[model samples]
Target: MRNSSPPLEVGIARWIEVMRRNLLLASIVALGVFGIAAVVIAKLPNVYRAETRILVNPQRISDKYVSSTVSMGPAERLNTLSQQILSTSRLEAITTELNLYPKERQALGRDRVIDLMRHHITIDLKQSSDGPSAFTISYTGGSAQEVATVTNRLAASFIDWNLRDREQEAQGTTLFLEKELATSKSELDALEERLRVYKVQHLGQLPNELDANLQTLSRLQVQLQANSDAQNRLDQQALLSRSGSYDASGEQGENPQAGLRSQLVARDVQAHRDLAELHSHYTAAHPDVISKEAEVASLDAQLTQTPASVSSRTRRSGSVASPADAQETSIHHSRDHLAAEQRQIESSINNYQSRVNGVPIREQEISQLLRDYDTAKEHYRSLLEKTYTAQMSMELERGQEGGSFTLLDPAQVPDAPIGPNRPVLYSMFLVASLVAGLLVIALRERLDSTVKSDGELHDILPHIPVLGLIPRISKTIVNRSPAQPTLRRAS
Candidate 1:
């Protein structure tokens, strides 16, 4: 039969026997792996991390007093600042100024150096109930002092960029509002000018002047009626005088002076009525009221002068009196003046009637103008208020009293390294070495064909019986002297 090792089985004894046979190989494998791990771990450089905390300080002034135009929250603000401060140009400048990453800059070039710097920098936000109230800037580097310095520099850059960005935003907002306010003012002025021109173009037909136009029309009508009445009386008197049947004693009176006095009194009464009506409608300063007052004064003067003139004429013509022809001529002359006055009044009435007729159209147009004017005025006022608030916000930003970032805890040089944990790494490698050693032993045992135990031989041929076991001798007679030639046999 072909000699071969017994089939392997799941037994502790078999594994123990196999392990003992390959103990030296397993030890060598384990020691080799452990040694390499230790050496590599020991040679690795130490990395130190330095951190700085920056608190997002809220606005010092109350929001009610002056609202900030910059409405970015802390996280968003930090993100924006990170973008600006961590740009290639900015990082390069900082590296050049601080003389960081000298070897990387020399070997990896400018771009690679900036990339490495960004990789080492970390911005961790710290949140609270309110929001992101603070954040920590961490930088890992080979040197302890270098990491600390870089972290502080990054924090400073972040703070400066935040301030500058916010100030620029505020200034821009103020400038924009100012421009808007100027535009609103211009529009307001244009509307005001348009209103003035419109009022001038339609003077007496405005909504406000409707009452005065009606009053003037009524006054003119009254004057026309009074004139007509006087003309009728004069015509009746002329007819009576021409027929030689005129009564000299009546309400008009018997003499020309009395008739003149009566006409003057009637005109005074009508003037007073017009004045009272005007007073009811308008104030004393109104044009219509003033005109009526003037008319009343003129009537008074005429009434006063008529008596003086009548008395003077009576004395001058003590015997020779006013003749019928003279009286009739005076009456005709008065009738002619009344006729002319009536025509003038009629013309004025037509003009005022046209004004009253056009009132609705003018009123509608004026209402639209007023509505637009009011809207524009309100808009201008609102813009003015916003401009003022924007100015105040700008001032607040300039003063650094608005939302800003402050260095809460400055970065300090780390006392110890944080990377390359030696003990833990050593333990991990020790366990891995054991696993590798066991795998090597199992592999060597699986490939070996030598049958070292009778149990394995019996298991391979279970149907056959094992009669005896051989105990091999350690010494051989060939290697010793021939006189000591003895055979060692197994039972």
Candidate 2:
């Protein structure tokens, strides 16, 4: 009896049986597909690839001392170089100059050719433990010589572009720093000028001069006080000289009018001294000045009256003029000089006091100016330093001493084609053909209802009982002669 397993649960033996029944059909399908693949692969054109390796050389000078203005890393630099070199205009120029892709250009136009060339060109970065240390520029083409030339051209373009870009960046940085420095300097100068003008406008009243101003004011005050004391002493001396000379009994010695004249003279000196003191402290239009002037005028009137009275009395009484009269006149002149001196001292005191009082306001103004000036000076100094650095970097780039690309390995004509590796492709196509053959076998088996296996028949009729089996007759025995048909056909 046959096994009753389902047909869908096929084992290795069942799979072998299925494969055997369709082996010829499977072979024809697989071989036919493989033959077509072999023909197509053989007819395909050979593509050549050429590469140029470039090392990303750092600045010759140490970065610690003269850092390059361009701070891009190796990978980023290569990418930027790739974009710039592979730009439409640049590629177009290279294509025209090198006469690259001439057939593609004719067939597909300039734009399409550029796209194809771009696709064919590749830039691959080589990274190390440190970073991307080098990169390769490769171009694929039909001809080895053309690919090598184009690759070398691209490498040259990258190097040249890196140098030119670095220089421009350095120069641009320098120019920007210079402009900022100029602006900062202008601001600093303006602040300085303002400070100078402010100091000049308020010479004695600046913050730094506050202490000196106070000291000066104190000195002037003392001098003024001393001057006033001296004036008082002169006043006493003048009074003493104007008084009449006494006899041995301390009697009035000269004319009787001497006593009245002495009194008038002392009053006049006191009034003049008071007027000078007031004139120092107040302006001409002040009330104190007005009052002092009125008092002085009254004293002058009193002097005129006393002198006239003394003269009349002296003439009427036939009294001799005092011998001390000339001394009295000289003393009066000295008093007048001392009073003028006192007034000058008092004026100086007032001037210095004004300066002292203005210290706080001037100090505030000057402090503001100083703060702004200091800030601007700092900014200008920083900008100056940056500008100097940028200039040095620019010079370094111009000298080709900064970060640059060195062609480590120039592209050369390849002896062998880089693509259409026939053996690998042939193996891959062989796999695809096998898969196609399996698919065809599966489709053919799915559509046919013929039960080739007892397992398949059992799957369709699970409840059926098989009591006996009919053995398959061999084709050789069926084609045998009928003369042997009466004999039992048993092996």
Candidate 3:
């Protein structure tokens, strides 16, 4: 035969009766637990937290003209700064200065003290929509004033560290650029000197002189041609006058006649040659040819004016005629002068030709030197500009005009402790005590398996039927003396 389970309402009613019977014991246990919890909570130390807010300010200057040297963002910079500030040395210093963790330092030594201090320091970054990133630096301590002081000090330290870091970076960059500028300037100066010396050494062969050289060469060539033509005409005229007829073939012999007529004919041939040479080198209206023609006409007039009888008389005497001798001497002197002039013109032509031929070579060499010089100059100028910018950046950093930290909210002394919340502790103690009381009652019930109700009995024996029901007598009534002699019987 299977046993039947008790009904839900009957089980609940039986459990309520069992709890009523055990109420005194449960209350004793609950009160004891509550007392212990209260004592433990009271013994815990209170911890106060103080916080300060700092803003990461952007640079005052625009990035377009002068850029900031500090490139790290607020988040990255905060991480780095947290590491540095929380380092053992820094934390130890802070601990010593603030007189923090006296008991912990004594129990766990200085290293643990520093570690504990670092653990208590918190850095939380908060970014805003319109402003730069702001961060909160908070520290937990036993005393509110001490916590506030420590937090403020830490914030100040961060500000100082940021300033020193940025200034050092900016100054270092400036120094580096200054050194580079010096080197560039030196190089530029050296190149300038090299170019100057090269120009001096190769005076006529510089790229800048190319046009002037070409013009000079052209003019010299023209003068050379004119001089050569004049010389040739003079030679031809001398030959023609001596021979007394022009030779188209350029073949002529000296005249044997020794008189004024010979000299006159020589002079006339010279003049015609000069005019022809002028026509070859220039236009028909040349000044030199016109002047020579006029002289030639004057000479012809003098020749015609001389009497033929006078010449015959002189020829008969066979003595050298005075006027004819003078004429011959003059003609020889003029020829010598022409020869010297031609030699000078030839020398000038050779000089000009040599200069013209060397132009391309000089141009190539000068172009190479100038190319190098120009490159150096450009590099020097660029470095100079950067040097100026670096100097300005350094100054800006020194002035604290670049990205920096500003204390937005100074650390304040907290009025209340942040930890060991009393109300929450009391509430938790009450809940825990209630749960403990319920567990104890449940444990006792489980240990004692005897049936306490009719329903439990029914569950144990479903086929059995109750024959009778007896009322339980109270212990108080049985222990009491008989209503005693008051005895309703005697009454």
Candidate 4:
């Protein structure tokens, strides 16, 4: 079998010969492809991009004292602004105002024009360790001036929109707080009115007056005690006077001492009745009940002592006699005087006891009213404070002291176009054309299967061997040779 692989040097020589044979065709193809690329590159339009830089500045006031209500970060805010600025309506407005994409508008209508304009716009956010967050707004157009104008307009619109949005947010918050404050104030007023009415309805029963009520109760109790003691002393005096001896005969039926005793007994009965009435209203532990018991005991002791002292006096005066008629008349007058004194004392005691009994009831009622009033007052105060804070925050936003975007760099008309890079396009086209030319040469070389060298001839017919060889010569070289001498003889 014949070896199919040729030596490297022989293969290289064979390729060189093939290239030389096809040199003219390869050069023509390469030049044609390069020409087409140049024409296509020259016809493409240039695109110019203009950019504006915006810095997201921190709030003027420290956040430690007053924080900004706008909580969005630079990237998020940029995205939101981008959506708003690039919306259909906004882009349409920009397109109409700037006379942008006029040909596209005519060819594809308003929506397509707006879409094209949106496609031309771009936003990019930039952040650095040492500086605040910033972003760039850029627009591309066929003309440098138009691109710059559109970019600047978009930037200005964003700034205006941001300011307006912030102010509106602040004003809206303020308005809402104002309404809440009004509602809270109304509620507070209603509570105050209700409290006032409650206090009026239960005048003496408020908690704040508990101490004073206790003090008055104590004073009244003391007064009631004093009056009881005086009534008891009078009763004792009347009892002692009544205990004195009296003659049965030649006596007017009314004994002076006896009338006085009768009057004292009636006053004692009235006191017992008043005590029973007090028991129905108050417990035994109550001061009024205790005082009444002490008075009753004192009156009983006075009555018991008076009878013994009278018995002793009667025994000592056994030998003495007196007219009974004069005694009886004097007794009647004395008894009337005692009765009047007893009635006055009883009235004073009753008045004091009533005052003491009423104090605790009044205190409990007043306490409830005061508690409700205090609760309402506290709520009102809290709402007032919150309203004040809301007002301050609104004012801060109105003053434009919160986080905001500042135009760091305005868009300027570019001196040069940013796109339709002719050099790069030309380079790419050059490479593509060279590759096509090479591919065409390789395809032509592959299709032409004729033997061109000794190694190829050997591969085609390895069984045959040749002793003599005929060398090939160019037709031009053969024709250029001098003619043989036979031509001269014929002439």
Q: How would you encode candidate 1's per-residue C-alpha lDDT over 363-407 as one tens digit per residue?
A: 999999999999999999999998999999999999999999999
Indicate the TM-score of model 1.
0.72
Predicted candidate 2 versus true structure: per-residue lDDT over 1-491, tens digit per residue: 34565545567677788899899999999999999999999999899999989998878999888877788877887888788888899999999998987878878888898899999998888888888889888999998889999999898889999998889989999999998888898999999999999989999988788888878876766666567667667777767754433322143444455566677767866876776576546544679878887887887687777642243324544766554555657776876787678667767766777887788888888889999999999889888988888999999999999988999999999999978899999999999999999999999989988977666677788788656556666768767857455545553
User: Clashing residue pairs, candidate 2?
Assistant: none
Return the lDDT, model 1, position 125: 95
Candidate 1 vs candidate 3, lDDT winner: 1
What are the clashing pairs of model 4?
205-362, 205-366, 206-366, 207-366, 207-367, 256-331
Q: How many backbone clashes does every candidate have? A: 0, 0, 0, 6
- Where in model 4 is the C-alpha error above 4 Å? 1-6, 62-75, 106-119, 129-131, 222-249, 253-376, 451-455, 465-491
Steric clash count of candidate 4: 6
TM of each candidate vs. truth: 0.72, 0.72, 0.71, 0.71
True-structure RMSD, every candidate: 10.1, 7.8, 9.7, 8.3
- Alpha carbon lDDT of residue 170, candidate 2? 91
lDDT score of residue 453 within candidate 1: 79
Residues 1-491 of candidate 4 have per-residue lDDT tens digits of 12544577667877788878888887788889989889988987889999999888777888667655555665666677778878999888888877888888878978777777878888877878854488889998999899889999999988877777776766776677678778877877887787788778756556565566556655544544454455445445544444333333312253344444555565674575566456445545679978987886676566545432233323446845333333534654654564565455445445545545666786676577667778777877776776676667667877878767899999999999977889998888888877777788799988989876666777788777745455775666657767634544654
lDDT of 4 at 380: 73
Give candidate 1 misplaced runs (Cα > 4 Å): 1-22, 95-117, 245-328, 451-491
